[model samples]
Target: MSRFPTTPDLDRLFRPRSVAIAGASTNVDSPGHDYVQAIKNMGFAGPIYPLNRSADEVAGLKAYAALTDAPGEVDLVISCLPAGAVLDLVDQCGKKGVRFLHLFTGRFSETGDDEAADLERQIAASAAAKGVRILGPNGMGLYHPGGGLSFRPDLPVAAGTVAFLSQSGNNAVEVITRGNARGMKFGKVANYGNGLDVTPGEMLRYLADDTETTVIGAYVEGVPDGRGFYEGLAAAAAKKPVIIHKAGRTQAGARSAASHTAALAGTAELWSTVLKQAGAHEARNQEQLLDLMLGADMLPSSGGRNIAIVGGGGGRSVQSADAAEENGFTVVPLPDDVRRRVREKAPGLADWVGNPVDQSILAGSGLSSNGLLELMLESAAYDLAIANVGEDWFFGRPDASDRLKHACNRLAQICETSAKPVAVVLGATETNNREHRAIVDEVRDDFAARGIPVYPSVERAAFALGRLAGG
Candidate 1:
């Protein structure tokens, strides 16, 4: 038999028709309360049985004393009980024929207590014997909006095709919240803390075959099984774009991860090699991970490294050139045909402007940056393009809001009609000017609503585009 050959049925787990929350409470502050409230808030289309020993009701639903008491077939049981109470919970789950048991309870092996570690081992053994798949002993569990599931009540309700797996619950929340702002609508998400029974490997294998998941992103502290993880990762990456952000690189970081999830961290170099060999992209940090996933999910595939950048000022052009070249992209010079087209509209810029298309020099020219972007993408000289919004420049002009909105609308139209991918660069809302910040935010929201990928900097846009282009 293969070691880790069998993967869990994640479809049933992710899309459970009936769910029960053990240790459900009425206290509005606790995780127990959060789970119950979150499910109710998500408009779960199934029966929600809250298993509470004392409370008669939890978050407006009648509470059962135990999982066995829940009057119907329960597909998934979320345990918010203490670690000491988990062994009994597992037995109850088995007796009830529960398909999945997600333990939001912590203080297990990650606490570095011998008794706790032993208890965790026993829980895993019992769960396996009962044929009930475990999601976490100290994790936040699932957040699939499409299936009416969420770990938190405040999360966005939009359903998408992007799937993400993380070891830390907070990290998972950050990625979902932040990625959503970047126009990344997430489909399935799991934060399997400690990764006791259903490891990242198993999740990857499941997601590899998942029809709903178009792109996969992972935030890993460590893996319980290395070879299995690699195989699963390789399988998934071969099918769709997979971006892995492996944390716990340094010794201190590893030690922290060990405490955080009882995970045994590996060397950064080794992890990098493994990720590359598995045909997956490696992200150094959370920011890079989000950027890569966003690019892979939002932009169409591009096999060429030739980049056409149009927007920003002369300084931005220089920085963009440096960023593009540094990231292994060729900032190709403007083709003669493109230059002649520019000369017809603006004779002065045809000679002065090079590849980056300095918007400053074309101030008086009837052509806008969006116009230049359309023209550049038309030529065979470029494979992909980047258009910089340069909101700071707009802030200095008359009627910044109207002008910015007009430019962005044109850019959005261009992106919609263009055959090649165009990544837009809009500065972060870092300005002290309130009006400027609001205008920038509105523009970003507009772009996001139109499904245009916007990066905070030209360098990030370049990096994401370059990596996606296989540079």
Candidate 2:
């Protein structure tokens, strides 16, 4: 038999045949008990064994006193016990022949003390010796739509292409909550806190082969084995886009990370070199990270770095230009031919029809003309095109009801012919009219269906373009 089974190992951990909650509780408020109820509520098909020495039944399921008492082969064991008790539980799991373990306890190696570090090492050795894989010691654990394993009560976990892994539990929850609000869904999320046995390298290697995951994102504090991390990232990045937000670079950030995950904070330059060599895109902040991942997840691959910026306002165009330059992309000026075409097509437009290709004149005329947009796209001067359509274009003109649809269709045709990526930025105030917001939503959906990403801000759109161009 293969040491690592040819069959996918995650099925047992994520969609187990039988699950045993080692620290099962009757209180609905407890994390341990709430998760058990979440599994049942989300319609897990497998039998659930809630293990508690004091209880006979838990959350309507038959309770067992220990792993050994649970009937048949228990594929997954979710231990919500204290850190001190985790070792004994592992011993029990080994004897019981449990294959996968999900630990939710903190204050282990992440504490950065000798005792905690030794305890973590021992647990790793024990699990490896028993041929059992561990998820986390200080992790929030795993989430699978099919298995309904979510510690977060607010967000409804759903299966999608994106799979995320993070070292910070709060960051994991924040990403899930925020992404859900923005219409971004996930297939799986693992908060690999402290990373006792399983490192980001191992997780990336595993996720690379997972058919359920298409786009991978990570919030990494530090990598223990730089070579292994780089190798694993290279392999995974070759298969799919890997967006990483590496924290703990600064001295203060490093100190913060020790408290967060007991991670050894390294120099920022070293981290940047490793990430660049590994073909991974490093994000500067949380918002940029999300935008980069969403863009990579949603947009098709492209070959060129040339970009065209279109906007109804000159100010938005300038903002796009600044962002593009800041993110390592060259903002090319429109060629003479392209400029002449734009001027002829929209005579009402401004005379400064260069790289930005402003359509303010046409938009201001209340004509709803996408002529300038089409002219720039057809010029083939750019590998990607970004259009910033203000709320005025959508709600200002009485005859501009179909302006968004017309622009979207034109952009789609341009993308098809050029085989280049296209994105849009629809800027509207949070307190904008419902009708104007509806137009922005419609445009976003339409562009998404065509495999183009839409952003609410020009900076975000430019950042996404930069990532793709960098890759």
Candidate 3:
């Protein structure tokens, strides 16, 4: 029924029974040694063959002179040899019945030399002829956890539904580590540098029906196969939420991308239009990309723009209102019915309450700040709500720390029942204020555990919500 492989394959590339690190070595700083150690660090429960002609061992693993000399069958080979030498390695792999060869070797077409480009082409042709798929003439290869493989040691150990395919090796690590801190767990992530083999479009096709992947995030420097990308992205986005961060958006950025990965950074305008046509959200920066995924993953879509602000004093309320309106949200006044309900709860204080319900004004009143929020949560006047987890203010009061946690629990419970999007704004990632920072950190974790997305600032919260709503 589906065109893509229902079962993961190029199977050995992911779940290799035996992986031969072709150029694996004992050098502390070398990538050759890093691959072996990285995999071992990830706790891969498989036989590892270190293929080195000269070295007796690599990273303290048993060394074989070649793939053919290994004690047993080899499912995958990671080639860290010179570019010119990859052709010979491919031939050996074909003879050994190796299913996949990861060409970690670079200095091919990326150097912009005609001879190097020709050599890359020859290797690709040879691999294809022998029924072997090449990962890269220049790439970081795969990082699939379920199958027990990883290229870098720092990647998250816990597997998740987020799948990321990045063209920049270092950027892939950055996104993965930073996103992991924000509770963005991952499923399958690959850094397909120079994309000589296993292009972005092909990865998309396979990921489209990948049940393990609920969300797909990608960082592409270029798209040489525009038509293929269009088709694959459209198909995948049809099944799951797709967020793309197209890096090369300017003249300077284009030049950097081209030199960095030998990519042809297409015009920003055309890329933007293409993303819209394919129904993919285009993120301008890494933070924005992270914001959008959180919106897609955590918030429910009501498709309505009305918002009721619930926390922050008059100053914070005004600032939040500006941000919400700037991001296409209608900060409507509290409706009469909701006000009447509030009046019943706190007869004396309801007269002073409005949309924002300044916490200071309601302090001495019989009504709690959360009671006003409960009224706003149900009001039809607002399609969604923003509750500021005022953690900074809660400090120094009697039993205030525990109250903050309880307040967050209440907001999380309200969100669970509300069909509408309810974004919470917590403050300060600035590290100088460790006390405030520590409090915010624990509260953010509390919110995260309760399945609430917290933003550092009101503007960021509003901006992310706006993009998720497509306004």
Candidate 4:
């Protein structure tokens, strides 16, 4: 009943059988060269027709002078041509029966020029009349590794199930690069810059039913159709976890967004209310967005707010407790059974340590922070947990690397085996010591490789867990 195509039909747009890059060029620095090289690098298993008016070959592929000159049918057409030339390109795509036309071309509407805005309107009208869906008039288009499609050649080639829809191309690139570094694998990603013919709402509706996508994250400056965006967001959020970062909250930011993407940005209060009512988690910035996405995809669903905190020294333990409680998680006290086990292991310090088992006090005892974590998770007192690696303490100790690795290995195993969700916290590698940095990086990478949710700080870990647990 919706205007947007369901998953089956949307697949054709994403996984196009054949692609054509209009304005394909020989210069490697330009986007024209990047599209051709990107799809080729992604190993797109389809005919790639590079449409160029003059060049005989672009990116080592035979180039056509026009869309009509291509031998095979073109399913997706990526336009890098000038703004003035887009109308003709759209007509060519319509005549060729092209289902999608991604305009990497800009300078229309967002330029704040009356003539440019008029041109954008005409372009929209023409595309609709010709039955051609335009992804963006000022956007970097799709990036679906599974479909062998990428806008930039430098993007990661590994396919994943975390789908993201961003209004800013640079933001999308940052999310992909940073999220991938933090073990967030992405599936379908689109930068619907101005949301001209194909709005973010329609994309949301499509991703809602997409079997390949398990979690969804979106970065939006504004929407042309507010009602449609709301409906689409509510529908998607009803099915799976959705994280939305709405930028352009301030007046200046709203103006910038308008000039940046021709978007009518909304106020912070209005967007916050809408996101909450729509059943989607609201992220304030890129960091929060990535953290929420990581939590949603990697951690299991937890219904209770009771949390068990472990690791770190006295100061970090206090900090962790404050963070957990501030994020709406109850730093539940260790139950009698856990205390009984602690007494059995180390009777002298059983009462000294509380919910957050201070690693400093348990130094000589046979019990490790990981051991306490295992015992606490086994009890019915807690529903989730946060484990701090306290790498700084290990750095000062004898044989730091070996001890750190051994502890981290045990902690990772505990996280992997635990029925309740445990978010690991390893401080950001900020020390000047080169060896220490490597050890920290190595351990964090290991955790990521094992598909464990690891955060740089306890506060971030608590915030992510709290949000995911509906706190």
Estimated TM-score for each candidate: 0.98, 0.86, 0.91, 0.98
lDDT of 2 by residue, 91-175 (tens): 9999989888888877787777899889888888989999788888788887667466676555565667788899888898888
lDDT score, candidate 4: 0.91
lDDT of 3 by residue, 257-303 (tens): 88777899999999999999988889999988888887777788857
Clashes of 2: 1
Which is the winner by TM-score between candidate 1 and candidate 3? Answer: 1
Global CA lDDT of candidate 1, please?
Answer: 0.91
- Which scores greater on lDDT, model 1 or model 4? 4
| Backbone clash count, each prediction separately | 0, 1, 0, 0
Model 3 stretches astray by more than 4 angstroms = 1-12, 54-60, 395-403, 416-419
Model 4 clashing residue pairs (backbone): none
Model 4 steric clash total:
0
1-471: candidate 4 lDDT, tens digit per residue: 454445325677789999999999999999999999999999999999999888999999999999989998888999999999999998998899998999999999999999998999999999899989889979999999999999999899999999999999999999999999888889999998988988889888888899999999999999988887887898899999999999999999999999999999988999999999999999998889999999999999877999999989999999999999999998888889999998998887688778887888888888888889999999988899999999999999999999999999999899898878989999999989999999999999999888898899999999899889943
RMSD to the hidden true structure, all candidates: 1.2, 3.9, 2.9, 1.4
User: Which model scores highest in lDDT?
Assistant: 4
Q: Judged by TM-score relative to the true structure, which candidate is superior, 2 or 4?
A: 4
lDDT of every model, 2 decimals:
0.91, 0.75, 0.81, 0.91
